[model samples]
Target: MRSLADLNKQGVVSFGEVIVDYISNNKDNTSFKQFIGGATVNVAVRLARKGISSTYLTKLGDDEDGVFVKEELVNEAVNMNECSMTTTKKVCKVYVHQNENGDRIFHSYQNPTPNEWLLDSEINSHIFIDTKVTYFGSGTLFHEKSRRTTETILELAENFHQIIAFDTNIRLKRWESAELCKKTIAAFISRAHIVKMAEDELLFLTNTNSVKEGLAVAVKWAIPYLFVTRGKEGAIALHNQQYISTEGLNVTVVDSTGAGDAFMAAVIETFHDKGLPQSKTDLEELLTYANGVGAKAVTKMGAL
Candidate 1:
């Protein structure tokens, strides 16, 4: 059986924001639920839940919220060798709104946290030397120190036989301009071995509403694998000169907060299970499994 520990032993390191997700239920008077989140963090949790030994690299304030976040990571069994508490900024929080259609919108509160906090530590490549895969989120690329840190890490790992995955988890409100977001995200996509873009996200990034056109653009940039997730309709994946589509599972939706992250976790798990460099048929299976996991995630209130 493929185990999370096996993947970890081989090497998997996730670099991104680790935030406290403050979620509110649209039903039952909009009660709140707090969960440890952020895109890569959510994927790391799911990987750990499946027995993968994963390490999360991010910063959190040395406060109650930070305590909660750390406790959650420990409970999930994610490697925290590089995680640290920052005295400079409080932990970031994302407040989410789940509409009746199960779509989620979010407002973020940031602390001007710098990526130097992580680089200044003992994060030698040897610690993640075994890591065969490195995952990063686009949000971190918005800040210079953090973006440079992520870029440097990827540069360092380039010599290693590793697949670099980038999730274009765009937050336009966090950037200074739309042009900057597009430029930075496009640059990352051009280099990523695997890239995931939502239907709406492609429209925003490419300024093109057509999926075919957007994917064509992605292909022109030389991205090896491109996944376009269309909410409700399902997701389409392109790999190795073939296109495969997976229909979304039918389920009662509550909050769609973590669905995409869940989908990502499932993709990684399936890829790890099948071993490196999957065929088109293998890609289809992975996308189907990921969609199921994503559908199930929306049935709950939080990212967990």
Candidate 2:
């Protein structure tokens, strides 16, 4: 198996929803900011920033937000040629409310929208031919039409024997029910070689509060590697049968919006660089680096 570094950065691609995150200011109801978002594309952009080339595949509307997001992707050096389009644009409305003590609350609006209309025509075997990985965003896995398209993309990726990665970027509102989400995630788990999950997502996937119990699910599914994210507590992972955990760094968080996306992006890059860790020390270093990436993301406003 060739690592991402081995492919010289040409073989990594991110596939799924690509939309705009409209961040509204709660203090001033009239003001807002727009950031290019969508978990899978964020990974592609992050990889590009880190000097890796990656293709972003998704559908955008021929509208203002879509144009803005496309321009942002261009600035990020992510390939736009592989992306498709729709007639209506889709966006996530994120309201950031704050209390006197400076604590913040986020209310988000993300559902079946234009981005979910990604078509099968937008993909083919050639996308994975030179790619070492075809990473999918879980946000696109709930919709029937988009999920079918995603499954088709994965089929092509698998046919090429590319590394298939999945992130349980599980936002409950994206699915019909929690039960359905779990079923969908499990199906993805069975298909992917790498899985990136938040601790809460791990609990849901494992159906138990205990990390040990959750790990058992990974073993049951024959998942080779599982990365568990723990916000400020850092992260833990089970590689093959070895367990590795890394400590968190002290950083003042600005907006923790896309921290998980950044962390997963690093995980993909690191996995690309060396395939997988050969020793406990190597694994720990990777976790430490991933933690730093997540920390850095919080210091920024959006996912990218």
Candidate 3:
């Protein structure tokens, strides 16, 4: 395994959308509060907070919401040198509603300039020169232009010999159809070195009723590492065709908006610090720590 010292110079690059989340402040969903949030954004910020060097790559609109997102990333000490700013791209906005149990529900999304995204021609390979791992999700794949850009980045990452981590942070509303969503995600999964998905996502993609069955189907993808996270039930990992599970933490839940992103950050951090797991024991430890990080994220109101 590579030592931490050998990997400290290389950071993780997070590529996806950054949205201004307008969360409901009351049960009626009438009142709202704005927060900088997104799946990949939360992961990048959480990784920075954990003292890991993190770089965020996304195209932001030169608007107030975009400015707010940039300032927040700056406050979190996340590197944004590769991020793009343009007047054509409006920062995406999402409305989050909470149930009685404080679980987040995506009520709606507003994006006036849906087609504008980071273009493949604008992407510079230098961004991955010091990157050990490149992380992305399926949120941006709904757009044709963005999907091409994503493919380009993934190809570049592969050429650079960087670890590719894919988080199937599925937002069904973003895609036109569930069939398309599943097909696109499967294509990406085949290229990932590590894959993370919620238990619900596992069932959706594999059409399985249980985690074990889901793993049995996904194992054919031949991904080096696969994790299925079950909220409050802990998590499960499938490595080398073997499965291991862990119990979730019991904590007072305030909000569950960014829990999964926190878990992804923890997983990436472990890989950065210790390289890939050498044994089942090593994989088990990664799951336990990731579950704890996810549990801790829900104790707060906002993702950051």
Output the number of the lDDT-best candidate: 3
Quantify all predictions' global Cα lDDT against the true fold.
0.74, 0.77, 0.87
Q: In candidate 1, which residue ranges exceed 4 Å CA deviation? A: 1-9, 27-31, 100-102, 112-117, 120-122
lDDT tens digits, residue span 43-160, model 1:
9999989987787887766778677778878888998777866676567767776565646777555555543345534356775567767788886888877787787777755656
Task: For candidate 3, write residues 1-304 as lDDT tens digits.
Answer: 1112223447888889998889888778888888888999998988898788888888987888778788889889999878899987788889999777656798999988988899888788988777888899998688998899899888877777788899999989889999999999998888788899999999999999988788889889888889889999999998888889999999998888888989988999999878889998899899999999999988988876
Q: 1 or 3, which is superior by TM-score?
A: 3
Q: Write the per-residue lDDT of candidate 2 for residues 112-178, one digit (tens) a residue.
A: 4634577776685576777788898777788887888888888877776777788988877667899
Give per-candidate clash totals.
5, 1, 0
Best by TM-score: 3
> Which pairs clash in model 3?
none
Model 2: how far residue 186 lies from native, Å: 0.4
Better of 1 and 2 by TM-score: 1
User: Which residue pairs in candidate 1 collide?
Assistant: 4-51, 4-52, 5-51, 11-131, 11-132
Q: TM-score, each model?
A: 0.90, 0.89, 0.95
Residue 99 C-alpha lDDT in model 3:
74
